[model samples]
Target: MDEAARRHNEKMKRIKAARDRMMQDKTEEKGLIIVHTGAGKGKSSSGFGMIMRCIAHRMPCAVVQFIKGTWQTGERQLLEEKFADECRFFVSGEGFTWETQDRDRDIAAARHGWELAKAQIRDPAIRFVLLDEINIALRYDYLDIEEVVDVLLTEKPPMTHVCLTGRNAKQELIEAADLVTEMSLIKHPFRDGIKAQQGVEF
Candidate 1:
């Protein structure tokens, strides 16, 4: 082999050895509390990806949408149509907080969504639960953080993974989650006077 190719192979060999050692130490499996937050987009999109993963494995799942209420989303429609028997979907908001401008009404809707989420979390048969946009509800004080954390840590099924997605996730939630991903905004179409398009933004 050429000198350059021999060096490249040696580098890859070391990388593989290190990766194998890391993998060997990760033998335990348990349900995860995943959080997707920050100002960028794709928070909910990532949560939906996890839902698809669970569905592909034939694992029961549930979704509780706390904001974006009744607004048509392609992922919701696809899940409802293709995996109706395995997924329970709920929408409990009346659009954005600015649209409603009613604190009491927003609180009521958040509570309703939380009730549905709790039900899903308690269901042993449900292997995954997606609390879509729930971070925004928590950020607005529509739901009590302590109560939400308490139930998630104590009452959720041992093998049930849960995902909470939205901007401005609370520090408490991030500290409790097993995995956290923050989407940073580098560039967006909206800043360039582009409108949200079907299949891309929705």
Candidate 2:
């Protein structure tokens, strides 16, 4: 064997040994609070991907959209068409806050969405719950952040993995999450005069 190939093989062996050792003491298994936030896209998209993972495992899952309107999306369509038996989906927002322009209505919608989210979270049969765009509601003060965080952190079923996805997630929720991912926006086509097109934004 060449000297470079031999050195590479030895390097991989050492890395694998170190990784195995690092994994030895990580034996605990439980539900996780996952947060996806920041200025970039894909927060809700990532949450939906996790829901697909749940479906692959034959686990019951629920999706509650707190601020997304009734527009159609590919993920929502696939979930409703093929995975109806394993996933429960809910759309609880009329549109964006600016589009609604009514504080009372927005608050009421957010609260109603929170109620549905809590039901799914409290259901022992459900292994995963996606509260999509809930942080946007919280950011606008449309829902009570304390109540939402309390239920998510304490009242959710022990084995249920709950994911909160949106931009500008509250600090309290960030502190409570077991895994937190912030999608940083380095560049976006929207700034380049490109509009959101089918199969891309929706």
Candidate 3:
């Protein structure tokens, strides 16, 4: 072959090798863990997006929500009406953290929710789990970090995905996570004395 032909052949060889590697990587059985944290909005929103994506693919999903039980939104209503059997939604039942200042009680509630989530996490049929506001519960010591991490590491089936949402995720949890997304608050309407909009922030 001529010089130019030789160069072109080398490039083609490199591209083919890269393609093979990519295919192998895609075929590997790997689980995905996503953590959305920081003091900002959209943590739950981002996590919900993953839930929708999984459902679109006909994958079973489980959702365990800590705090904020009363104000129902489009997602809650839609999940209730549409994907009731496919997912599970649990509330802490005491509204916000400050409202339920009892640490022991809060921890107990979290433990109960975690127990339910543990079963879903182990189920190979369930492809995705969205642990909404779970990080905050861990940060506030409401949930046991060791127990959560153990479940994440051991209970997950092949190709299972998990999304955890809340503010101020613990360092250990962040370190253990595969993907960590921090939603930093740049500007919020609440700062301007505006109340949360219905169906948007809810």
- Which one wins on lDDT? 1
Tell me the tens digit of each residue's lDDT in model 2 across 1-202: 9999999999999999999999998998889999999999889888998998999999999999887776788888898999999999998988788888989999999989988999999999999999999999999888878888899878987888999999999998898889999999999999989998887777
The global C-alpha lDDT for each of the candidates, from Candidate 1 onward, is 0.92, 0.90, 0.81
TM-score against native, each model: 0.98, 0.97, 0.83
lDDT of 1 by residue, 85-181 (tens): 9788999998988999899999999999999999999999999999999999999999999999999899988889999999999999998899999
The TM-score leader among the candidates is 1
User: Model 3, range 128-153, lDDT digits (tens) per residue?
Assistant: 88888888788888788987887798
Count clashing residue pairs in model 2. 0
Tell how far residue 53 is off in model 1, in angstroms: 0.8
What is the C-alpha local distance difference test score of candidate 1? 0.92
In candidate 3, position 113 carries an lDDT of: 72
Runs of candidate 3 exceeding 4 Å displacement:
1-29
Candidate 1: lDDT of 54? 88
Query: Which of 1 and 2 is the better model by TM-score?
Result: 1
Which window of 10 residues has the lowest lDDT sum in candidate 3?
86-95
List the candidate numbers ranked by TM-score, top first. Answer: 1, 2, 3
Better of 1 and 2 by lDDT: 1
Answer with 2 or 3, whichever has the higher TM-score. 2
Q: How many pairs in model 3 have backbone atoms within 3 A of each other, for residues 3 or more apart or on separate chains, i.e. clashes?
A: 0
